[model samples]
Target: MSEITNFKGEAVTAKPENAADLEVEALIRSVGDRVRKARDLKGMPRRVVSELSGVSPRYLAQLEAGEGNISIGLLLRVAIALDLRIEWLVGGEDPWSSDVLRVADLFRSAPAGTREKVLELLSPEPPEAMRARRICLIGLRGAGKSTLGAMAGAKMGVPFVELNREIEDHSGMPVNEVMALYGQEGYRRLESQAVERVIAMHDTMILAVAGGIVADPDTYNLLLSRFHTIWVKASPDEHMSRVRAQGDTRPMAGNPEAMEQLKVILRSREALYERAHAQLDTSGRAPEESLERLLALIEDKGFLT
Candidate 1:
C-alpha cells in the first residue's frame, strides 16, 4: 500500500511489515517533536529538566532526538516535571492550541473572585444556596479567628472548624511538623484539600482559616465561593501581643523588625482581604466585646439565613 526506495535507488512496493515499521518510526518522530517544542516553549534546558525529572540529560537528548524508545515510567517522570498531563505529550491534538486546554489555563490563572463569578454564571445553584450558612473567618495569625470562631460557633449552636487543625488531623501530625516536612507548596496543597473536606462535610458551620490562604488563588477562590467570608482584623501590635500571649513568641523572637514585617504582610494582603463579604475589626477590643459584635454583625447581615 506504500512505496519505498530500495538501496539500489529503485522505488518498490512496501511490504505490510515495512509499512508498520514506518508508522512506528513516524510516531516516535512526532513524540520527539512535541517534547522538543514543549521544552522550548517552557524555556527549560535539557539539563534542568533532567534534574527535575531524575532522568539523565543524555537520555533526554536521545528521546528528544526521536531516537530513544522511552519507557512509560520515564516518560511519566518527564511529564510530571514539566507540570503536564502525560496524555498531552502523546495526544494527536495540539495541546497548546486546543480550546479545552486554553480555557483551562485561563481559568487557572484568573483571580479567585473572577473565577467564582464565572462559576456562578455557569451553575444552576444560586450563590446563597451554594454557600448555605457557611461562615469563614480569615485574617492574619493572632487576629482571633480560631478563638472567636469557636466562641461564635458555640454561641450560635453550630459546628466550628479550624482549617489547619483539620489538616493536622488528616495528616496525623502537628501543623508545625506538616510545614517542616512539606515546605510551603506542599503545605498549601494540604491546606486546599482540608478546605475541600470541610466544605464537603458541613453546610452550616463556622470555619477559621490560615492567614496566608489568600496567597493561593485557586484554594482561596474555592473558599470564597463556598463560604460567607469575614475578614477579622486587628492592629499589628495586637497581632504580635496575642501570639505572644498564647506562648508562641516565634513571631518576635530575636526579630527587631517583626512588627514592621507584620505590617508589610498585612498591607500586601489588604486588597485580597477586602474581597471578603464582611469585615470585623477586633483591634483594641476585649474578647467579650468582639464576640458580641461578631454575633451582631452575623445576625445583621443575615449570614445564617
Candidate 2:
C-alpha cells in the first residue's frame, strides 16, 4: 500500500490507514466544540439543551467532549435544539453571514480530501431572516393552533388568520351551522375557497387552519404547496381539556362514547398530521411556551430565512 502523508507532508503510519479518518474525526470534534461554545455563549446549559433535544445529558456531554460517535438523527436533534442547522453545526462559518462571494471562495479552495470536512464546519443560515415566510398551522381540534399561531404571528410581526373564521365570514354563518347545513363535502368546498382567499391575500401570514383540513386532500395539498405547515399536536387528554375550556362539550356531550371517538379520530389522522413540516407537542405546555418552540423550529429549519 502507498503511504499517506499529513498536511505537513510527514509520512503517516499505515496503522491509521490514512490521514482522512483523523481529519474527519478532528472535524467532528471541532464542530462539537463549536456547538458547545455557542450554547454556552447563549448562557444555555447542557441540561436545558438535553431537555429540548430529547438527548440524554450524558450523551450530549460526551458529544461536546468529542468522545461520542453520534448518529445523524441525534445530531439533527441537537442542532434543532440549539436553533441551528446541521450544516451550521458542522461548518465553522458564521450562520448569519450573507456574503456569497466569501462563501464561494471558502468552498473553492477546500482541499478535495477535506472538502466534506470544510462543509461540515460552516454554520447554517439564520431563521430570523425568514420571518416574512408564510406559515400554516394544522392539527386536530383543541391542539391550540389558534392560540399559538396568534402568539407566533405577533412575535414575528405577521397577521394571524383563521381559515374557519374566514370561511364563516364568506358564508355569513357559524362554522357548525355551515357544516350542518352543507354537510362534510360542501363544507370542504367552502374550506378550500377560504384557504385560497387567505393564500392570495397575504404574502406572509400565520394561518390557523381548521383541524380537519387534512381530510380534504386538495385543500391540504394547496396549503402545503403555498406555505410552511406545522402541526400543533396534543394528547387526547390535553385535547379534551382544551376543548372543554373553550366551552365546547359537543365532543363529549355527556356521551360515554366520546373518549373512544376521540381515540379513533386521532388514530385515523395520525399519519396525515405527521406530514407537517414540523410537529409541536402542546400537551402540558402553555400557548406561549408552544409558540416559542414553534419559533425555534421555524428558525432551525430556515423557514425564517
Best by TM-score: 1
Query: Which predicted model would earn the best lDDT?
Result: 1
List, residue by residue over 259-283, the lDDT tens digit for candidate 2.
8888899999999988888888989
User: Against the true structure, candidate 2 has what lDDT?
Assistant: 0.75
Worst 10 residues of 2 by lDDT: 123-132
Every model: Cα RMSD to truth: 12.6, 20.5
> Which residue runs does candidate 2 get wrong by more than 4 Å?
1-132
Candidate 1: give the clashing pairs. none
In the range 23-99, model 1's lDDT, one tens digit per residue, is 76677667778888889888999998898677788777767886666666678668756766667788898877768
Each model's TM-score, in the order given?
0.64, 0.56
lDDT of 1 at 221: 81
For model 1, the superposed segments whose C-alpha errors exceed 4 Å read 1-118
